[model samples]
Target chain A: MNALWILAVNEYLDGLRNRWVAAAIMLLGGTALALLLVGSAPTGTVGAGALEISVVSLTSLSVYLVPLIALLLSFDALVGEFERGTMLLLLTYPVARWQVVLGKFFGHMMILLTAVAVGYGAAALFTVLVSDSGTAGWQAYLTMMSSSLLLGAAFIALGYLISVLVRERSTAAGAAVVLWLIVVVLYDLALLGVLLADHAQQIGPGLFSALMLASPTDTYRILNLTAFDSVGQAAGIAGVAARSGFAVSLLLGLMTLWVVVPLATTMALFQRREL
Target chain B: MVNAAAVEKVIDVAGAVKRYGDKTVVRDVDLSVRAGEHMVLIGHNGAGKTTLMKLMLGLTRPSAGRVRVLGADPATAGAGRRRALGYLPESVAFHSAMKGREVLAFYARLKGIAPAECRSIFEQVGLDRAADRPVRTYSKGMRQRLGLAQAMLGKPQLLFLDEPTSGLDPSLRRHFYGLIDTLSRSGTTSLTSSHSLNEVEARADRIAIMKMGAIVACGTQAELSRQAGLPIVVRLGVRSGSGARVAESLAAMGKIHRRDEHRIDLFCLGASKMVVLRQIAALGEVVEDVDVMPPRLDDIYSHYMENVQPQ
Candidate 1:
């Protein structure tokens, strides 16, 4: 356990020295502020509070950005160390293979958490000062920020799984990009196409919920946008959100599983790897 | 301080075989290194030197047979048990963004040692001047020094260094062996792998030459040289006027490899080297100076590597 903590701190410091933390903060913070400023124009016409509207807008933004950032941060974690030859020396020490896996997870999650909190926190603070938003607005905004982190964690775990499965960093990078496109971009479009073409009304609410839960990004979107009445109505998903029938706790549970299953699989595979 | 009778086998491998699929990387091999012994594994590339080292380090388990280090199964040894072992891999690397001190401290921490002890290790490997510099700015030699420093941390009882001197300058290579000698004197057992036979000739307590995933020969330099039965060359610088006379008089002694006005090279078996030398001494003033050359580690290594047929 102590070794795990040391490795975690080492990885975190490496991220800082590599300027990954700084870059993630700048990218997330810059985009969040941009979406907050230009996107708040619709609040007056829609008759929704500023924080609630921002939550709706940011949910759309995070579904694209969070997974992209998370995957980029973690795809090279294992394979890069193997290529650089650091992993060989590291394993020579008293550390177990699982510690190496969890150490990287905890460290990269800290990076993502920092970016999400600071970036979305600034936007939340701005919304509070400028608009007469209420407790409900603040509640919805906090949900958005935390769920975005969970969403990021899920993707980071998936990236580590990719890292462990491939032998080369180049292959891991290619796999990560393909995984991102399938989960974040194409899954939703394909779902839309399938639903539209269901002239026989074959796809039911249960099947739709299962389909949405299949992709972590969609699961995160369902959690943040549909869990609240004002946010769901403002994002124009109230009809679908009402019919989806997924409890907030169940969505949170599914998000946690997304993080756990892939990370556990990564640990098991890395244990048997020669390096 | 450890007595000879009380000496332990720090590393023991018996009938160890490692196969990656159908291709066997480490054949049935048996090796043992006593405590305080400096054992060097010399081999060509893909000769399984690194694989053997990995087996002993617990990084890879053998497909069949046993590997024990410090009297424990290396593959399943606990963290506390592994603290006694140190390894420096071939072409060691660290996070390029980390400082030298930071890299050492990271390993020190993993070994449960205080980070403050990193200062003394920096001085040991002569990396103190570059302690604060990021590894990205380090040259290959400096990086190797840093690698040596990390392996020397916690005063480990066993050290496994794979090609530790590959990229080092001659002086740095000497310095590396000097450090190994210092550790050996203090009762640290080291098993190092190198393809450079000349560098380790005088340093290793015993040499194991590996080829095609198996050990062909292993012993002290003198012992292996004797067993190989290679000839000893005796070169003599003759007086200006006696080149012809010296060659004629020594014609029946042994094979005269080369002879000229300035020198004569004669090759004789080890058993007959002194007999041949006495014949030269009989012509006292005709031989101006005599130099006896024993079979070098290079010759012995080549003899074994070339003689062993591939399985």
Candidate 2:
């Protein structure tokens, strides 16, 4: 346990000193702030809450940026250590291999969590101060922040899995980018293609929901845009939400599963690795 | 539950073999190091010195036999037992973003040592002045010192250092061996691998020479020199006019190699060195000077490394 904390703290400090974590925070905050100020201008004329509209716009932006940031942050975690020869020395210490994996996971997750909270929190604060938004708007904003953190964590876990499976950092980097493309862009496009081809109307709502739940990016989009009625209507996904008949708890659970499965597999594979 | 004095061998490897696919890197070999012993492993590239060290450190398990360090199988040893072992890899590295002080503190914490002790270690390695700087700015010598300092954390009972002095300056290499000697006096056993034979010649209490994935010879320098039966050379600096006369006087003593008019080298076995030396001494004014050279660690190493049969 002590070893785990030591390794985790070391990794976190490494991230801070490298300035990548700070860059990620600035990027998220700047983009979210832009969405809040410009994208939500029509909300006041329409008589809708400003934070609700900001949530809808931010979710769309986050689906692309958050996963990319997470992958960039963690794609080299294990393979970089191996290449630098640090992992060989580290394993000789008193720490177990699983502790090393968990410790790095915690550290990377902390960076992502902090970036999401501070970035989205700053944007939400601006909305609350400049606009007349109710408790419902605040609640939807908070859910968006937490769910965005979960989404980033799921990708971070996937990146770690890639790091452990590959022998070289270049291969891991390529694999991470390819993984992001397939899950974030190609998966949804393929789903649309299936829908377009199914002109006979054979695919049911249940199958569609199951397919969406399979990809973490889709699960995150559904969770943020459809969890609240105001946000769902503002984002124009209320009809899909109603057709799917999914619960908020189920989507959150699926995102958590995305984090667990890949991370657990990374630990198992890392333990058996010869380096 | 076992006392230090009760265990004769700090590290024991019995018929250990390691195979990756069809290639056997470490053959069936047995090696044992006593407590406080300084054992140096000398071999050529890909001769399995590093692989054997990995097997004993538990980083890689042997395919055929067992390895025990500090009275337990290193592969299955508990974390508590691991705290007693320290290892410095061939090319040790740190997170480039970290400062020197942070790197030591991080490893210290993982080893269950107090972070405060890292300050003195920096001083010990002459890195205190640069401790606050990022590791990316460090030179190769500084990085090598940092590797040594980290391996000394908590004064571990056993140390496995691979090419520990590869990047160190000559003076620092001397200090490193001095530190190892001090640790050995205080009951710390060290198993180090090196390609620089002369650097470890006077430092290693026992030497293990490996060839073709197996230990071909293991003993002290004198014992190995004796076992190898390599000839010692006696060079005589003769007067300008006495070279031929001196060579004729010592013709029956040993084989002679004449370099020029002034010098002739006599090669004789260890048993006949005294007789050969006395024969030259008896030549009186004919031989101007006599220089006796014993077989060096390099010669013994080559004798074993070259004469071994392919496995």
Candidate 3:
């Protein structure tokens, strides 16, 4: 445990000094603020609450942005160390292989969490002050924040999986970008195409919801946009939400599963690797 | 005689074989290092020095045999037992963004040493002044010194250093070996691998010459020289313009090669050195100066490496 903490702390310090965490926070916070400003402008004319509109825009933004940030932050976590020759020095220490994996995962997760909290938290605070949002708006906004973190963790784990499976840092980086495209951009497009082509009533709502849970980004989308009636009505997913039977807990559980399974696989592969 | 039981074997490898895919990096080899002994491993590239070091350090498990460090299987040793060991790789790397002090403190914590102890270690490696500076600004030698400092943390019972002095200057290399000498005097067993035989030749208590994934020779300098059977070279400097005369007089004594107008070299076997010297003395005034060069580590290493290579 002590060795784990020491390794984690080292990684955290490395992240802090490298300034990527700060840059991520700035990027996320800046984009959230911009979306809040642009998104709330229509709330005054349309009579919709500012916080509700902001949550809708932010959910869409997170679906595109959070996974990219997570991948960029973690794609080179293991392979970079190997290329730099630090891993060879690190393994000679008394720490186990799993500890190194877990420690790095926790450290990168902390960075992602901090970025989400500070960036989205600032936007939420500003929206609450300027808009006449009640308790439900706050609850929905908080849910989006937490789900964004979970989505980021799932991708970060994916990045680590790539980091360990590939032998070169450049290859891992390439794989990470391709994975991001497949999961965040292409998966939803493919799902929509499938739904459109099922004109003969072949794929029903049950199969559709199950398919939505396959991608972590989709699970996060369902959790924030469909789990609550107010957010779902505002985000225009109410029709799908009424048809889907996935509970809020089940969606969150799926997201958590995404985080664990890939990370566990990374640990197993790293243990068997010669480095 | 000292009690044999009191003496400890820091590292033991018997019939160890390491293979990556179809190519074997380390063949069946047996080696052991006693406490406080400074053993140097000399080999050319692809000679399996690094693989042997990896096996002993538990970075990789041997494919065929067992390895023990500090009397325990290093591959399966617990953290408590592993804490007794330290290693400095051939190319040491650290987080470039971290300050020198922070880097040392991080490694110190990993080694279970207090962060405060990093100060003395920095001083020991002569990096105290640059301790507050980031590692990116450090020179190659300074980084190597920092690596040395990190390995010296917690006073490990066994140290495995590969090319430890590769980037160091002459004076720093001397100081580095001096530090190793001090550690060895206090009973720290050291197994260091190097390509430069001259640097470690005088300092090593025992030398192991590796060739083609196998140890071809292992012993002290004198023992290896005897095993290699390489002849010593005796150079005679005669009075100006008398080199050919001296060569002729010493022709029957040994194989004499005239170097120039004033110098001639005689190659004689180890056992016939004294007899040849007596013959050189018989020339009296003909010989101006005499110098005998015995076989050094490089000669013995080349002899073994050459003999071990397949024709």
Ranking by DockQ: 2, 1, 3
Give the TM-scores of the predictions, in the order they appear: 0.94, 0.94, 0.93
User: What is the i-RMS of every prediction?
Assistant: 1.5, 1.4, 1.6
Off by over 4 Å in 3: A44-50, A134-136, B1-7, B236-253, B258-264, B274-290
Please write out the lDDT profile of model 2 over residues B1-311, one tens digit for every residue: 75674267998889999999999999988999998899999998888999999888888888898888888888887767788888888988988888899899888988889989999989888899999999999999899888989999999989999999987889989988887787788889999999889999988999998887898989999999999999999988998988888888888877889999999998889898888877777888878888999999988888887786645
Cα lDDT of model 3 overall?
A: 0.86
State which docking tier applies to candidate 3: medium
Candidate models: Cα lDDT each: 0.88, 0.88, 0.86
The CA lDDT at A89 in model 1 is 90
Q: Where in model 2 is the C-alpha error above 4 Å?
A: A44-48, B2-6, B236-252, B258-264, B275-289
TM-scores of the first chain across all predictions?
0.95, 0.95, 0.94
- Tens digits of per-residue lDDT for model 1, B184-222: 888898999999999988889999989999988889999
Worst 10 residues of 3 chain A by lDDT: A41-50
TM-score of 1: 0.94
What are the per-residue Cα lDDT tens digits for candidate 2 across A1-275? 38888778777877898887799899999999987777756664544488888888899989999999999988999999999889889989998999988898889888888789888888888888887664447888888888888999899999999999999999999999999999999999999999999999999878887898999998999888888888777877778667666789999999999999999999999888885
**Greater-TM-score candidate between 2 and 3:** 2
Clashing pairs in 3: none
